[model samples]
Target: METAVADRKDTLDVEDLAELCRALGHPARVRILEFLKKMDKCICGTIVDSLPLAQSTVSQHLKQLKSAGLVKGEIEGPRTCYCLDRERLDQFKQYVANL
Candidate 1:
């Protein structure tokens, strides 16, 4: 029973890490993150204008980034503001270093 519990916990951790990695699997998502890093904060429309991709494409990438916990989004009335989750990114960096 103890071993089963340990295995389950390990599985969950692996899944979580894998999900984050998968979220970053696209080049567009990486570019979006880079763009966000340069700004204090941004909205979806601004990101769409900066990138060559269409608005819908940028939105998809933003969705993935937000889902990964690498980006934080706040609604400002009609618009959703976005910024990098620096702490989470730092944690991911440390995880890679340890690996």
Candidate 2:
């Protein structure tokens, strides 16, 4: 293996925060989080009922959550279920605590 020099400076703690914050930047996502937090877990279509936005819009927000690792989704036959990723949430919280 070859040794490599590492940068001693230039860091952005906001990378993770930026990803998460961007995913949550929309009002739809904020509502989705609230709904999921209340139920703790829910089917994909179930999220549509809680928000005034279109189902497709809600799906996009869910996609953002998935990308941010804030939510986990899996197919169940013809439906999809979503639930919080507690690990990521805890990690993010710890990041905030350190700041």
Candidate 3:
């Protein structure tokens, strides 16, 4: 229904929505984002302890989020610190707001 607004600009196709939704479709992913948002930034170990998911599973979800340009993680020592990609997130916010 809200897609009518999107139609006026660049039409958002299923692939685009799928990528966005896929990155956000899981409860674990949502939790991860929420935690990252609250903490501002956290390491892999931090996110692992914050949720019940295994380290590998959390890493997979993080990868998906990164691929969607919703999150970013940088390697530092043996751990990777993760945070929201604010610029990309703002783009997403603008897209939704316009829609």
Instruction: Report the lDDT tens digits of candidate 1 across residue range 23-64.
Output: 888988888888888995999899899889988888888989
Q: Candidate 1: TM-score?
A: 0.82
10-65 in candidate 3: lDDT tens per residue? 54544565677778889998888888888888998989998888889989999999
Off by over 4 Å in 3: 1-9, 12-15
**Residue-by-residue lDDT tens digits, candidate 2, 13-88:** 5677677778778888878877777888899999988788889988888999989998999899999999988788
lDDT of each: 0.85, 0.81, 0.82
CA deviation > 4 Å runs, candidate 1: 1-10
The better-scoring model by lDDT among 1 and 2 is 1
- Clashing residue pairs for model 3: none
lDDT for residue 2 in candidate 2, whole number 0-100: 25
Superposition-based RMSD of candidate 2 using all C-alpha atoms, in angstroms: 3.9
Sort by lDDT, best first.
1, 3, 2
Q: Which candidate leads the pack in lDDT? A: 1
Give RMSD to native, each candidate. 2.2, 3.9, 4.3
TM-score for every candidate vs. truth? 0.82, 0.82, 0.80
